[model samples]
Target chain A: MIFRIAWRNIWRNKIRSLVILLSVAIGLFAGIAVLALYKGMMNSRVRTVIYSETGHIQLHHKTFKNDYEARFVISNPEKLLQELRKNESVKQVATRTITQGMLATTTGSAGVQINGIDPAMENKVSGLLQKIRVGSGFEPGKKNQVLIGKKLADKMKLKPSSKLVLTFTDADGNIISAAFRVAAIYQSENTPMDERNVYVQQTELNPILNLGNGIHEIALILKQDTATHTVAKQLQQKYPDLLVEPWQNLSPETELMIDTVDITSYIIIGIILFALAFGIVNTMLMAILERTQEIGVMMALGMNRIRLFLLVFLETIFLTLIGTPIGLGIAWIVTSYYHRNGLNLESMGKEMMSNFGFSTLVYPEFPTEKLLGIMGIVLFTALASCIYPALKALRLRPIEALRK
Target chain B: MSTVIDAHNISKIYNKENIPVYAINNVHLHINQGEFTALVGPSGSGKTTLLNLIGGLDKPDEGKIEINGIDITAMSPNKLIDFRLRNIGFVFQSFNLIPVLTARENVEFIMQLQGINKTEREARIQTLFRQIGLEDKMDSRPSQLSGGQQQRVAVARALASKPQFVLADEPTANLDTASASNLLDIMALLNKEENITFIFSTHDARVIERARRVITLVDGRITSDTAKVDTHVQH
Candidate 1:
């Protein structure tokens, strides 16, 4: 009977009740959509770093990290590469000969990390060939050729087929200079990282530096991220002398960004829930005040204070329960549509996004695991909103209530 | 007959600034079992205040109220609620039936609070509905019923618990003459047949004329207490 009365009481003022429902629904929808957008943005950043810059795992000579000197080369590169290629978990692998060098033009010189890469194997691991914005990436018979970032080429006032001098220390610690032609200029999402690094053919650069078929780094892209730690562990056990690092260890900044974005989304939802609570409290208080006389009559007829409190509390819960599902449904529909078609923020400008290594078009992703938590927050808000009003109902003396 | 309600020097005061305004002043009253009593007074005469004190709904300024030998004035608020639920029934001026509930539900509400079984509750409600001539409107909500029918539902609810006494405040104020006369006949019949005491505060001549004992108040003080000649009781 109490429940029946509570339920009926919710519809006493249909417009008032519906307004509360709509507010809760809209609040939840906005919170869910914002959370999805943030998740998509973070996912894009992590994928960009994994596929373009770090790969899932990297193996390097332990001493090569101190300073990418040509002398600290991996002694058995072919053996490790052959074993890794046979593993089912490994998708693609490439070897690089890294050295600190300076690229100089007629205008000026700038410090850079010159990566000597196998053109065929580097394409499989780094997707470097696809990011080439201009000029054919490396020719089959090409010698003394390099690919430079668009930013670096612009800074140097150089173009494709432009001759540039590369100076670095050889394996024997001798200062060697080689002139290489820029075969292509590539533009990647990370403008800063692209500007700091340049790539060249291993066949041509290794002979000039007296590298003798040795490599500094062995990078592998796994089919799935779940295999990264396992593959890294296997490689570590096989080559104890080498430093095998997974993507998380190779780039801790990206991992931290992912975690930080998750926390930030929760905080955003909390702010929305906090705001919605006040509206619910206001609506319930009005309802309580309006029904003062009726409540007074109930109390006079022997309904106790606890029952009166429950009547108000139950009414508020019913109102919220009605609104929350509608809100979640609206959120799901909007997110799903955007997730497929993508939300284009290109109008916000390319330079703004590129500076932060972000994509202009984001495919929003819904985190279904968070649905339970969202429902709990709404339930808690409903209960919290009812406290002041329900307490007021409890405080009503029968005599006074009857008069009102 | 045993005294059902004993109010000694009951007084209630309202505050205006720092001054005290007496609503009920040093009023003494005793209502015995099976008596049909009416408390008649004009506006601001404190008839409702005295009734509230007797019903244990409000505290008296300088007195005590005893119902069936228990000093309800000394009871805790929670205990008073329970005492009222089990011992006293109240009918408000506005027919105060739960607007959302049906007539049967309104009557069954008190029995449910007392934890009565459904069979017993239904049987008792059926008998009371028949007695109040509202058996046909048992399933009708307060809004669906007429003002007089709604009042009858409130009366049936008051008597549903088989309380020792009923306190009605202006129960017939909103009813027509015919409805008021029909309601008085039912109360008089119930008073004689079941020996249940009934006390009412009203300005209606119809209710006053029907009461076997009429107590008149002026300026918060009882001026006259008269017992009329009645031919209904054959003892």
Candidate 2:
């Protein structure tokens, strides 16, 4: 009977109840939609970092990353490469002879990192072959062919088949210079990386630098991204002399961004629910005030304080339970639509996103795993919001309330 | 007749901290079982205050009240509420039926609070509705019913718990002349048929004329108490 009374009491003022219900539904929908957008953006950035910028795991000489000195080369590169290829976890592996040098053209000169890469192995490991925008990847059986980034080509006023000079120190500490023709111009999602990196065939560059069969870095992609940490740990234990690092260690900024996404999402939803709680409290207080006489009569007729409190508590719970599902349903439809069709932010934030190495066309990822936590937060908010109004109902003296 | 209510030198003071004014001052009274009594007085009299004190809705300031040998004034708030639930029923002046509930549900609410089973509650609801002559209006909400009908539902609710007594505070104050007389006839009939005790506080002469015993108050003190010999003949 108390349940029936509480349930029916909410509809006493239809407009007021519907207004509260709508407020709750709209607030939850906004919170969930924003959460999905943030999750999708972060997921995209993480994918770009792993697949395009750095492989899942990178093996380097202990001191090679400190400075790009050609003397710091890994010993027995072919033996380790063969072993990595046989490992079930490793999908693809590539060896790189890297150097930082100055590239000069007739129009301009700029400092850039030149990567010595085998065309076939590097293409499999980094997917660089897919990023070509202007010309074909490498000419078959051609010497002195290089792949330059679109940003670098634009800045140096160089085009496909253009000739450029690279000057750097050799392994014996002597100055070395070579000329190479640009085979293609490629563009990546990251602006700074595109502006700073250029690639050349390892066979041509290794001989020019007087470093025969020397490898400075060995990078490998894993069959599954979730196996990155395990494979890196196993490889590090086997090769204690080399520096084995995972993608997270290779790029700390991306790791930090991924770590903060959860906290940032929670804070955003917390602020929204806090504001909605105030609205709930106000609505419940008005309901109680309007029924002062009825509550008084109930108290007089032997309804205890606990029953009165439960009545008000149940009414608030019903309102939240009804409103939340509607909100979640709407959020699911909106997020699923955007997740499938993609939300294009090219006109609004293309430049900014690209600067941060993110794509403008975002596919929002719904937080399916976090739905339980979201509901727990909403229930707690409803419970906390009902306390004040229920206490007000409990404090009413039957004689005084009846008089009112 | 055995005494069911005993109030001794009870007082209720208002604004006790600054300037104390008495609402019920030094009032002593007794009521017996199966008696239809009325507390009649003008404005500013303590009729309503005395009714509230006897109904266990308010505590007296200076003295004690005992109903059926239980010291209600000495009981805790929770215990007093339980005692009221089991021992007394209430009817208000404005027909304070729960607006959201139908007439049948309002009558059944008290029995539910008392933990009565469905079979007993259904049976009592039928009998009470039949006695009040509103059998057809059982499913009607308080808003849908007329003023007289709502009052009759309130009366049925008061008696549904099978309480020792029913305390009615100005029960007919808002009713029209015809409705008031109709309600009086129902109350008188229920009193005689079931032998249920009834006490009312009112300024209405119609209610006072029908009551078997009349106690009048002025300035928070009793001025007169009278019992009529020909009450049945007058009805």
Candidate 3:
């Protein structure tokens, strides 16, 4: 009966109740939509980092990454690569002979990480071949063919089939220099990565450095990205002498960006809900004030304080509960539509997003896993917001209130 | 008849820390079961104050009030509220029916607080609505009902719990003469037929004329206590 009364009581002032309901609905929709956008942005960044830059897992010599010195090469590279290729979880593995050097054209020179890679294996591991924006990448039987980033190519005034000089140290402590024809100019979402990294055939570059088939890094993509941690841990245990790392460890910045997105989204939603809570408090307080005499009569008629509190509490809950579903439904519809069709950030500029390593077009990813937590937060806020109003109703003296 | 209300030298003072004004000044009174009593006085005469004290709606600053042999003044607020739920029913002058509820729901609300089951509550609701002559308006909300109809619903609500006594603080103050007379007739019928006690604080002559006992107050002190010999039900 109390529940019935409380439910009915909200409709007493139809416009006032509807206004609060709309406020809650709009607030929740804004909060959820922003969360979805952030989630989408984070997911896009993570996908790019995993598929375009780093594979799901990478194995390197213990000290190879520290300086990329010619001496610090992986032990038993062929046998490890063979074993990894046979593993069911490993989708593709590629070995790279990485060396920091300078790439120079007639116009300019830039510091770059020259990746010595097998055309087919590296293509399978990192999908680098699909990103080719210019000349056909690494034609059959081609030697000393290099793939330079579009940004780097543009900076040095070089194009496909242009000749570039690569200078680096040999394994035996000698200056080694080689001229490589640019095979293709690729464009990745990350402008800095695109500018700093270039690729060439391992067959041509390895022998010049006298590295003797020794590789500096072994990168592997998995069938499913979620299997990354388990596969990395297993590989680390199997090859304790080598250093195995997941993409998250290999790119801490991306991992940190994900965490920061989660925190930032929560903070954004929290601020919205915090503001809406004030509106709820104000509305409920006014409702209580308007019903002062009725509340007094209720108390006078022997309605217990707890029951009275519950009545007000239930009224607030019903208001929020009704509003939340409408908000969630609208959010789901909007986000689902956007998720499928994509929300283009063209107005924000493609170059700005590329610089930050994010695609200009994003599909909003609704955080379905966080729905329960979000609802709990909203319920807590509603409960907390109703406290003052409920307490005010409880504080009314029957005689004094009745006289009002 | 057994005494249902015993207020001994009870006094209620407002603004005691500032300029103290006694709302009810040390008034001792007793009301028995099956008695239709009226507290009559001018404005600021503490008639409603005394009714509130007896109903356990307010505490007396100076003295104790016992209702149904329990010292309500000494009880905790929660316990007093429960005691009031089981023992006393209230009817306000403005016909303070919960505006959101229909006439039947308004009456059922008090019974609900008393934990009366639905079967019994429904049965009593039908009886009370018929007794108050608002049977046809049972589903109507307070706002939809006329002044007379709403007041009848309030009266029905007061008796729904089958309390030891009904405390009405100017129950017909907002009603027209016809509504007031109709309401008084219902109360008199219920008093004579069901033997339900009624205590009213009012300035209306019709209530005073119908009440078997009238206690008049002036300046928060009782100036007259009169009882009629022939306590017959008046039309």
lDDT of 1 by residue, B119-218 (tens): 9999999899999998889999898998888888888899988898999999899999988888888888988998989999999999998999888887
Could you tell me which residue pairs clash in candidate 2? none
TM-score of chain A of each: 0.94, 0.94, 0.97
**1 or 2, greater by DockQ:** 2
**Cα-based lDDT at residue B193, candidate 1:** 93
Pick the winner on TM-score between candidates 1 and 2.
1
Cα lDDT tens digits for candidate 2, B1-235: 8889999999999996799999998988888888899998898899989999999999999999999988999998888888899999898999999998999999999999999999999999999999999999999999999999999999999999898899999999999999999999999999999888999999899999999999888888888878785332111
Worst 10 residues of 1 chain B by lDDT: B226-235
lDDT of 3 by residue, A1-404 (tens): 89998898888888888888888889889999999998898889988988888899999999888888988899889889889999999998899999999998889899999899987888887789999999999988877899999999999988989999999988787888899999999998899999999998898888987899999999998999899999999999999989999999999999998898888877777788889889889888998999998898888888999999999999999887888998898899999999999999979899899999999889997889879878988898889998999999999888789888
> Which model, 2 or 3, shows the larger TM-score?
3
Candidate 1: tens digits of C-alpha lDDT, residues A139-159: 878678999998899999879
Q: What is the DockQ of each candidate?
A: 0.73, 0.81, 0.80
Using all chains and alpha carbons, the TM-scores for the candidates as numbered come to 0.93, 0.91, 0.95
Candidate 2, number of clashes: 0
**TM-score for chain B in model 2:** 0.96
Model 2 alpha-carbon drift over 4 Å, by segment: A104-110, A172-175, A209-211, B16-19, B229-235
Judge candidate 2 against the unseen true structure and give its global Cα lDDT, from 0 to 1: 0.90
Report the C-alpha lDDT of model 3 over B1-235, residue by residue, as the tens digit.
Answer: 8988888898889896699998888888878889999999999899988888888888999989888788999988888888888888888888888888889988888988888899999999999988998789999988899998898888899898888999998988899999999999999999999999999999898999999998888889887777786543221
